[model samples]
Target: MPHAIKLYVRYVDAINRRIGRVVMYMIFAMMGILLYSSITKTFFLPSLWTLETAQFFMVGYFILGGAYSLQLGAHVRMDLLYGSWRDSTKAWVDLFTVLFLIFYLCILLYGGYSSTEYAIQYGERSYSSWRPYMAPIKIIMCIGIFLMLLQAIAEFFKDIAKLRGSEL
Candidate 1:
């Protein structure tokens, strides 16, 4: 592989790794919020913000961890035939299919950007009683999708290298 491509892969992988590690802790935050919700509902007036806040944390956790999941090959796949394929054969298939992933992510990112723009323009807020501003989470969603797109491209390059009997 060329030096620049190698560097790109390394950089994307590094960023995702760091972000994933940080995002992993968000599950605990979500759990804490839920626990507080349970406690509050049992003993006192229910908090409107807890449920919505927990939901936002869950969304952030899943979205932000996506690239790292891909990097780790932790995403699900139908393995009826795939599990038996040779490594090079798998690489070829992955290279071809990654194009579809790239295309889909492109569409998703575009839509996410449009929605985010609308949210910012209108100062959108969730419909919940808490009515939190939507821009921050929408922006985070866009960033996560963009990072996933970049990681997909890096995976494509890695597949190419693998087909050539090299690893990136």
Candidate 2:
């Protein structure tokens, strides 16, 4: 690989790793909040904000952790046919799949950006009693899609390296 490409890949790998760690910490924090909320609700009947907070954390967990899941190759895939393919065939299949995902995520990023912008402009709020600002969640959706795009690019290059018998 060229020096610049190698540097780019290294940078992406570092970001992915850091994000993965943050996701782990967020999961733990969410778990703790859920436990606390459950206890409070059971013993003291906590305010609606507790439930809303929990829901918000859950949403954040899923959206923010999506890229980390992809980095770990933990995303769902039907491998019934893919698992049986030869190395070269699998490489081509993976490359095509990555290309498709890139295009799909590009569309999502565009749409998400427009939606978030509109939401922010209108000052949208959640319908729940807490009425938290909805724009942040919409923004999170865009960030998640952007991260997925980055991961897709990394995976594409990794696969290409594998197919070419080069170390990534």
Candidate 3:
């Protein structure tokens, strides 16, 4: 069971890393497109959809990459108090935080699942002119939450190992 859990954690970590890389590429692509659009607009005529497309990509990149950020511990933190704690105390605090995150992610996963299901059932489309299938994007929210949940679980066990004075 422990081996299986480890394998699952590794798989989630791999997926998170891959998604993070994709998000980086998407960001660069969006920047390039934005710059090109600005140049074209300044010199000749601007493309009608370039700015709008860039906005869409930005939204997708942020939403999809949320889990990757969480996994990498890159998310913002107000750790002034936490930063002063001893190693053992910090480990316990981290364990508690991971448990809290897991609980939150579980709720998000449930809500996102229902939202995605409803969107799919109704064939919901975005309000934008492009009218992209919003369901897929909504579904990505569920996936992100699930990934976060997995990472939280992993962190919980890692903290437990730390509390036991053992390296994970």
Candidate 4:
């Protein structure tokens, strides 16, 4: 059972890591898109969609990369209080904190579903000159949220295993 749990945790970590690496390529794409937008607006004709498309890529970068950040312990925390703790104590604290994380994810998933549904049903689009459909971005946001929630479960499992001294 320990071995199975360990494998599961590693699988979850691997999934996030791989996706995070792939999503990072969007940074280069965003830069190129922004540069093209700037050149067009400055020299030729302004492409209205380019800037907003770049913003969506930025959102994707932050949202899709969230699990990798959490996996690396890169998320900001109160070091003054959390840093002084022992490993075992930290694991315990993390386990408790995950409850709040779970609550937050639940709310996001619930609220996001309705928003996504509305966007799809009404064929929502941006108010810009080059109106892009909102459904795809909302769908991607939901996927990112789900992946983050999965990562939180993986973390909670790791914390539980830590307390048992069979750290994954």
Expressed as tens digits, the lDDT of each residue in 64-108 for candidate 2 is 777778878889988899788898888788888999999998999
Worst 10 residues of 4 by lDDT: 1-10
What pairs collide in candidate 1? none
Q: Could you tell me the TM-score of candidate 3?
A: 0.82
Which 10 consecutive positions of candidate 2 have the poorest summed lDDT? 46-55
lDDT of each: 0.97, 0.82, 0.79, 0.90
- Residues 1-168, candidate 4, lDDT per residue (tens digit)? 377778878998999999999998999999999999989999998988899999999988888999888888889999998888999999999999998998899799888888999999999998988899999898888888888988998899989988988768
The positional error of residue 127 in candidate 4, measured at the CA in angstroms, is 1.9
For candidate 1, the per-residue lDDT at 138 reads 99
User: Cα deviation of 130 in candidate 2 (Å)?
Assistant: 1.0
Model 1, position 113, has a per-residue lDDT of 100
Error of 2 at 33 (Å): 2.2
Rank list by TM-score: 1, 4, 2, 3
TM-score of model 1 relative to the true fold?
Answer: 0.99
Model 1 lDDT per residue over 1-168, tens place: 999999999999999999999999999999999999999999999999999999999999999999999999999988999999999999999999999999999999999999999999999999988999999999999999999999999999999999999999
Selected candidate, larger TM-score, 1 vs 4: 1
lDDT score at residue 103, model 2, on the 0-100 scale: 97
Off by over 4 Å in 2: none
